[model samples]
Target chain A: AQTVTQSQPEMSVQEAETVTLSCTYDTSESDYYLFWYKQPPSRQMILVIRQEAYKQQNATENRFSVNFQKAAKSFSLKISDSQLGDAAMYFCAYRRRTSYDKVIFGPGTSLSVIP
Target chain B: DAGVTQSPTHLIKTRGQQVTLRCSPKSGHDTVSWYQQALGQGPQFIFQYYEEEERQRGNFPDRFSGHQFPNYSSELNVNALLLGDSALYLCASSFWTGQGIYEQYFGPGTRLTVT
Candidate 1:
């Protein structure tokens, strides 16, 4: 069984500033994927970014990027130039690279973008 | 054009009662997955359905059953529900992964309240 852990229960960052959310997972499987999801107060869940275990390079999506440290089993999400819309509950998830595989999510970190 | 969708945005049921939740996969998606998200916690995987069959399941008990229709729609059924069953039930969909990790799209989720 794979378990994801997000140590930061809550985080705050000023608008236009950069923030990094910590995420760590324990998985025996060598081939898997990691993901970041955002859920606003409206409860709409959205994908932010993803990374494959085999890839040593990180994944970047516009303002969102990840620092994937495979050796430490750490996949942290860095939000550069954070916006107000970035204030939400960020969840770290793990998924197998197999067909119809299930995903496990972390407890989540509530990010507050202050103006 | 539609993303993943779940029916009965909110539902209230009594303990020991049964409940059914529906889901509609996103356009061009063929795999559907169910999850349970508690009040401040991350979503827990329930099961994944593809081609009208349950391809994977979580550690949930037999009380949690599901069905997928020929149209790619799915339903989650819980028998003899308990108070702990109250949570936001989320439905997500992704393109069938013959070989790659496709990002999943989620719905707003169906909030189930067991009183």
Candidate 2:
């Protein structure tokens, strides 16, 4: 069974600064997908970024990017130029390469963008 | 286009009672997946529906069941609910490619309280 882990329960970043949330996973599959999701106080879950295990290059989306280290089983998210809107609970997820597999999510890291 | 939507933003039920939650998939989406998110935790997969059939399921018990309609809408039903069942129920919609499922969009989620 695959499991996702987010070690940090809480994190804070000053406005306009950068922040990084750490994530690690255990999986037997050689190829899979990793995702970062954000949940605001409104409680809406939104996809932040995703990385494919086979891709050695990290994934970047605007201010959100991922440092995906397949050998270390680590996938960390970096948010640059952070704004107040970035304050939210961030979750790391894992999904197998199969078509119908279910996603596995970590506990989450609550990020506070300090003004 | 409309996004994924869930019914009864909030619900309250007594012990041993039964509860039903509904979900409408996003436009052009053909797969619906259900998840349970407890307070201060990440969402846990319950089950997924595709082509009106249960394509995949997580580690949840049989007490939790679901159905998918031809239009890609879905429903989650819990029987003899317990206080432990109280949580936020989420619905995610995605397009199923022949190889695998890509991005999944989530709904606001329905908060269920079992007293």
Candidate 3:
């Protein structure tokens, strides 16, 4: 069985600053996918960024990027130049590379962007 | 293109009653996955449907069943609902590339309240 862990229950960052949310997982599979999703109060889950296990280079999507340490099984999300719109509940998720594998999600970390 | 869509934004049902939630996949997406997210917790995978069949399921009970229509629309049916079943139901859609599934697009979830 695989499990995802988000150590921070809540985080806050000043607008225009930077913050990092930590995540770690346990899995036996050699190759898989890791993701960061943001859910606003509107209840829509939005994909922030994703990383492929086999890719040694970390994934980056504009202001959102991941620090994926495969050997340590740690995947963290760093938000640079944070904005008020970035305030939301962020979830760390995992999925296998297999065709139809179900996703595993960690308890979210609520982020507050201080203006 | 329109992202994934879910119906009946909110639903309130009594304990032991049954409820059904509907989802329409994003345009050109053929695979649909369902997840349950409790208050303050991350979404938990319930199942995934592809080719009108269930291809993967999580640790949920049989009371949680689903169906995928020929048009790629899907429905999640929860029978004899319990208070524990109250949560936000999220539907995600992705393209299946024969070898794997692409990044998923999520819908604004349906909030189910069992009282």
Alpha-carbon runs more than 4 Å astray in model 3 = B97-101
lDDT of 3 by residue, B11-109 (tens): 999999999999999999989999999999999999999999999898999999999999999999999999999999999998866645467989999
The residue ranges of model 1 lying beyond 4 angstroms of the native Cα positions read: B97-99
Position B115, candidate 2: lDDT: 99
Off by over 4 Å in 2: B97-101
- How much DockQ does model 3 earn? 0.87
TM-scores of the candidates in the order shown: 0.97, 0.97, 0.97
Q: List the residue pairs that clash in candidate 3.
A: none
**Best-to-worst TM-score order:** 2, 3, 1
User: Residue B87 lDDT in model 2?
Assistant: 97
Clash pairs detected, candidate 2? none
TM-score of 2: 0.97
Model 2 chain B is weakest, by summed lDDT over 10 consecutive residues, at: B94-103
For each candidate, report what fraction of the true interface contacts it reproduces.
0.95, 0.87, 0.89
